[model samples]
Structures are given as C-alpha cells and as structure tokens.
Target: MTPRRRRMVLVALIVLGVGSAAAFALTAFQDNLLYFYSPSDVTAGKAPTDRVFRVGGMVPEGSFSRASGSLEAHFILTDYAHEVKVSYTGVLPDLFREGQGVIARGRMGADGVFVAEEVLAKHDENYMPPEVAKTLKKQHEKPTNSGPLPTT
Candidate 1:
C-alpha cells in the first residue's frame, strides 16, 4: 500500500479508537454516578429506583428503631416537609441520632423503603453535610402559608 494510504488508515483507526474509549468512559461514568436527593424528592418519585443514590435529611425525633437481636435499624429521614423510611443492617455511626443530619446511600426497595448499604451522619456538632443542609434549607424556604393576600 502507498505510504499516504497507510497514514490515512492509521489516522482513521486512531480516531475510531479514541471515540470508542470516550464512549466507554462516558458509559461507566453514567452508571457509577450517585445522585443526591432529599426525602421530599424521594417521596415525589424523583429518585431512581434502579440505581444506588443518596438521600439526605434529619432523622426526626422518635423515628429510630432497631430490630430485636439484630443490627438492623429503621428510621424516618425527613426534610420537615416530607419523609423517607430508611433501613440499615449494620452498626450506625457514633454521631447518628434523631433530629440530626444524615445521609444514606442505597436503592429504593420494592416496598418503598430505602435499603441503605451505608449510612453517614454528621461528624461534628456544627458540621452538617452540604447536601443535607441544602435540602433542609430548601424545605424551610418553601411557603407554608399560601393564602390569598389581604387588601386594605
């Protein structure tokens, strides 16, 4: 084959290889990406049920429970406006408690429960996860009283 033809073929192959690699990388990224959602989002059916994702919120007071003779725990995570039930079958963090910021990574179960593989709690007294903070803030910012305006 002529040198020019060989060079052209080589360039075409290089381009094809690069394109394939890019596509592969993108696909992997998409598959592995974990999205963060609030309890409100989950209750609204905005979270993906097929993939693992994160749900962040405050564990409401008196909503935590443990199974008898097991490490399994169940809690309700709420942004104050909505709540999602989370089940974790492991030891919880030292700082985990009711009315504190927590983030659970897992997928939604068939029974509408979030089956958490990992549960994370705020590390310090003043340090809430940014996502949890944002979610809480968003919830509080919502208008609770959407009433008709009064006129003079």
Candidate 2:
C-alpha cells in the first residue's frame, strides 16, 4: 500500500478502538448506576421490583420498630403523600431516628415491603439528600394564582 494510504488505515483503526472503548465504559457505568426514588414513586410503581435501588424520605414518627430477639427492624419511609414499609436485618446508623431524613438501598419484596440491604441517615437535622430535597420541594410548591413563575 502507498505510505499515505497506510497512515490513513492506522488512524481509522485508532478511532474505531477509542469509540468501542468509550461505548463499553458507558454500558458498564449504566449497568451499575443506582437511582434514588421517593415513597410516592414506589407507590406509583416507578421503582424496580427485581433489582436493588434506593428509597429516600423521612422516617415518620411512631414508625420504627425492632424485633425483641433479633437484628430485624421495621420502619415506614414517607414522602408525606405516600409511605413504604422497610425491613432491615442489621445494625442501624447512630443518627437514624424517627422524623429524620433517610435513604435505604434494597429491593422490594413480593409482599410490597422494602428489604433494605443498607440504611443511611442524615448527619444533621438541616441536611437532606439533594434528590430528596428536590422531590420534596416539587411536591410542596403551590401553583401561583396569577401566573407561572418566570424562568431564568
């Protein structure tokens, strides 16, 4: 082959290799991505029933309970509009408590309860996960009587 033709072939091969690598990386990342959902989403059947995902909301008052002789515990996570029952079989975080923001990672059982593999509690009263905050803001916002708010 001519020298210029050989150089062109090499460049095409390099581009193909880089494109394939990028596509593979993106597929792997998407496979491992975990999404956060609120109780309202779960109730609306937006959460996956077969794969693990996160559920975030407030641990409502009078919703936490522990079995007497086991690590099993139960609680209700609520977004005010809906609630989900969560069961966990491990020690909870020190900061976990009723009326606090929490995120639990797990899958939903056939009976519609969330079986948590891990539970994370907010570090402070004023702090909430950004996803949870955004969801709550959207849920609580009132429509303006005059007109829609101006977009920036």
lDDT of every predicted structure (CA atoms): 0.94, 0.92
TM-score of 2: 0.85
Which 10-residue window of candidate 2 scores lowest in summed lDDT?
140-149
Badly placed stretches (over 4 Å) of model 1 are 146-152
Model 2: clashing residue pairs? none
In the predicted model 1, the residue pairs found to clash are none
Tell me how many clashing residue pairs each candidate has: 0, 0
Residues 1-152, candidate 1: write the lDDT tens digits: 99999999999999999999999999999999999999999999999988999999999999999978999999999999998999999999999999899999999999999999999999988899999899888888888686888899
| Deviating ranges (above 4 Å) for candidate 2 | 142-152
* Model 1 weakest 10-residue run by lDDT: 137-146
The candidate that achieves the highest TM-score relative to the unseen native structure: 1
